[model samples]
Target: MSDFRADTVSGKLTTFMHRARAEGVAEPVRHEAKRLILNQLKASVGATGQQAVRLMLDWAMAEAQGGGGAHVHWFGTSLPPALAAMVNGALYEVLDFHDTYIPCFMHAVSGVLPAVFAEAEAGGHSGTAVVDALAIGLEVELAVATMLMPTGYYRGMVPAGLTGGVGAAAACALLRGLDASQTQHALGLAMCTPAGIYEAAGSHTLAWITGNAARTGLQAAALASRGFTAPPTAFEGDQGMFKTHSDEDRAKIDGILASLGTEWRIFGQTYKVVPTETITHGPVECALAILPRAGGRVVERIDIKVQEIVVTIVDGRRERFGRPSSTPQATFDLCHCVAAAWLRGQFTTAETSAPCYTDAEVIALSDRIKLTADPGRPTFEGCTMTVTFADGSSESHNVDYFLGTPNARVPDSTLIDLLEQYGAGVLPAGRAHAIADAVLTLDTAPDIHGLIRLLNKD
Candidate 1:
């Protein structure tokens, strides 16, 4: 309601987050916040044993042996909040199972939660406090992302990396109870390094970017609390990021600002039913359905019709876009994902990893796949797939809304089971279940120490 946009992007986002913390998140939205946390925990902790996690953890232990008091989620190593943020953030990304904001293809809650948990744990903040900060943090993150997406994406900017720090900064500042001015400064400082590109997907660098964004937010909030300041025009001036990263549409920026408190961008999010790329969910589900009907036919071709974003990301001109070169790239390759899932008869996290990715049959099927963009479909989640056989017969299946989408939401009971399953991958038995329980009661819980312990405990 206040004049959030009169100053710069920093001031506006700060006002939006600060105002929400003051009024407290609405009950329904707080429940949704809890849902995001549970999903993030499931997604992140499940990836603790990954190569990316090992790399970050080894670095944290070696360099941050005596950094500070913040404990890494799932690893229990004590380090500075910034370093802890890095490891936790990387965990969210390595699996590529986290939720994405459809509008920007940026991770909705992954980057921000690491910052929230780091600040909350280090400062001993309450879970009720976490829900509020997490909600506000995500609100600002999604807000900033909405202003830049599609256009920014068109310009080769990665949304999570570019907008992630701003979201993280907002959450940390709110948890630390920084005043509006300092919060604005934190936002500006957090935007200093927004490095992400489409090419980084398979290099193990994409996950690290998420980690760096979390670290950026934690450091920005910490420095701002002690009087560190960044340029007021960091985002919108002549040589600013708005022009550099996005299409610089003034109306899009202004519209998100106006919709801030009332509209709730966080509510618009859709969680992934499958662990692969978000846009690939509908197609994977469609492919899996079509596979059962194929019976004994030898598949000659696999035709996929997706939304425009899929085509933009996978033009099929490049070999890597059509055929994955590595495990991480395979997660994003539409053809590989569809082929692998159809052959395996399931599209779980296992299908995205080794042996399965390198399997001969999967690669053969992926080569047979072709993608077409459907102009009529407006959203990123739906797709139509047709599988042709050697007998000159074909079958097609269309998916409008797969499970875990906002249109067809995954039930909380199902999500609870999912969290337990993912958490059990690296955790002791019953640990993940306890983690899910803590999240369900998070709104009323006194502090997040118990949840942190559940994640960090041996």
Candidate 2:
């Protein structure tokens, strides 16, 4: 194996992605990649009718009214490659049900999948090619994120939009069969276009950040493919990505490069069983676990002790916890999710909507929940919940790992079931099953266009 760390970060990544092969990837890694792809498709199809997705599709379609390029998965429409990527990417993230990389605090699939799908459809690439590009894209995104951590989110910048653009660009470059230099230029161009804020959490604009990242990335790769030039040191120079976006004087660039092809971070990605912020999942699980113990007794107060990250991101918005006006606000509130899960026994996509958010019973229970940061708790994956009944009795439950974490990964059957459930809302049962089957065996499919076609609603 060559020393990928010896080259510039961008150069090293370009070489790795350009040379990546499906056959070279381990079976388990490939399986995980397929699951991630399927998860993204499931999210896209599930959120097809969302107001945010509809708005983005309308805008993208209008932008590409005369020039058609590639298919937008599940929408049965074609737009220019960049516009298609934008719509598909927005759909993947609009529901906040996509896969997440814990280390980077980013949505791993939404950012990269749209670019890969768009480029593959436009170029008529194979499923193997799409898989390879996805793996490469994830690797680059994870590595960069790992290096710039402990600051991006703290500074109000959304990691998915900040780092996702470069990841999408890398995937597009690989699909376009660009040389190492061109791929480097693509990353450079993408690095200059980062735009997403933590404040977008409770609005439709949050999804737009994800969509814009996908579009910008595909556009960057397209420009690079056409001999566009960018500085070679776009990621490491005095005014590079790290300097501009990170508070760290020097990022762990060496460590990021050294682990390029040796480690597969995709295996560590977690699926969102609930349609809310990933940090709230543990608390939601805790709430559900204690529900049975509480029996028919009325709950008086619930105290939740979570990690610092949770308090920073989910607890600050106390006003929205009791009564959220929208799905985004409700999903961002830990108390709202816990209350809903406790009352309904499960948190599904429907629970994140306006009707559920404004439920009188849910609001009453949510108002009683109090959240506090546990300084000793190291990560946001675990939470301790104590619920006191009206009769003064109390029950406590601690959750160290949620359902979709690496330790408690959702089974393939559960994933298929989720896909069927979500897909059935938009697609026929037969079509949903067909789409699932094709995605499960996607590695062997001759062309990715067939898979995209199956995703269309008949």
Candidate 3:
């Protein structure tokens, strides 16, 4: 395999940006991307008041306002675009409620858009430009993430912060109309600002890293727009990103970028059927879907087959499973998800965030659940669930795909309804409806400023 780590990956990124900017995206894909963006905006805004989100936004807003370098529009408020991007990015991720891709372990849109929106708004780019930038950033981030999947990096390393800076840079380069060389410079600048850590997973640091990635990505790209430059060999060469942050599989890296435009990475973006939990646990949801059949009273032993990485992240915090104190803990807890599903018959944002997380009954049930990695199952998908009852009867269900994913796409109407459901908690009913409508109609809008404005409407 060729050493992609030693090659000019930044230059390749520049070339790809040129092709993306010049060729542009298909109308259909652009529309889909807009819809996804709208969904993410709603999700982020809805999570704005969350404790982790508030902390992240507070820091980001202070940083941008403190820096006073640029003015930008925040999604839900009149904050600077850079600040807004950072805060909104953080908010979107606070609940870990945003979209995720299985192959790359990347939180796809949320990480890139905050920066993209910030830069686009700051630069006064058109909605079409915003969409283009968003698509470019999304593609680049997904490409990098897909290239590095199944490696140790997937454990807790935020792919968004790592690759998102590059994505944001790509978007900024495209939006700013930078040339190929300048785009390379932007990418290099982005790589310098790789921000994320697995240690922040169970804490508020996850949101901070996400928001920071967005802000830094925008900063990097914005710098490149004005002719600022950094080391050209950021992604490749001896002292590059991969050698330091990840185990570089040169073949995978090259292959990820090889079939670029011909194969759309946008297709890899998967929406969430359930608003909580990481994408790695989607199949757990599939298993939980059948728990209602077992009857709430009879579930004696619950055995779940999950990916090893899922087990690692979820293993810690068994006490949380038994008694979830926070929304983040409840959502990320396998015991909570399954226990709630069996007891309440559903897994919605409301259920996970409910006071029931601390309820004795839920915790009692959670204690009965057990999760084990299925060696036969791929890390990306597939989950088998068995519910053995006290009545000497057992029921098992296996789900190959979650509600999201290309294999089982959520209906547009249903997804809209789900967004409305989430938005209703934070926004007025009419406002939520309008937001959903605006998202669906985002493609035809003149600019995302209006969309951003719409998202912030309480």
Return the top candidate by lDDT. Answer: 2
Candidate with the larger lDDT of 2 and 3: 2
Task: lDDT for model 2, please.
Answer: 0.82
Task: After the best TM-score superposition of candidate 2, give how far the Cα of residue 450 lies from its true spot, in angstroms.
Answer: 1.6
TM-score of 1: 0.95
The residue ranges of model 2 lying beyond 4 angstroms of the native Cα positions read 1-6, 249-251, 319-322
Predictions in order: lDDT: 0.81, 0.82, 0.70
Which window of 10 residues has the lowest lDDT sum in candidate 1?
1-10
Per-candidate TM equals: 0.95, 0.95, 0.90
Model 2 — which ten-residue stretch has the worst lDDT?
1-10
**Highest-TM-score candidate:** 2
Q: Alpha-carbon error at 47 in model 3, in Å?
A: 1.1
Clashes of each: 0, 0, 4
lDDT of 2 by residue, 143-245 (tens): 8777777687778788988888899998888888887778888998888778898778888898999988888888999999898977777788788888788
Off by over 4 Å in 3: 1-7, 60-76, 152-156, 279-284, 316-323
Model 1, total clashes: 0
For candidate 1, give the lDDT: 0.81
Estimate, for each residue in 1-458, the C-alpha lDDT of model 3 and write its tens digit. Answer: 21122247787767776777788788877877876776675466557567876665566566655553232222344466667777777777876667877677778787788777777666767877788778877888777666655463655477776887778778877887877667778788888778786666556777777777787777787787677877778866577777666775776677767777778788767777666755335645755667667555576788878777667667765543435677876776777777777677676766667576877778887888887877776754567878888887988888777777778776677667766767765666677667667666765677666666665544
- For lDDT, candidate 1 versus 3, the one ahead is 1
lDDT of 1 by residue, 252-283 (tens): 77878888999987877787767777877888
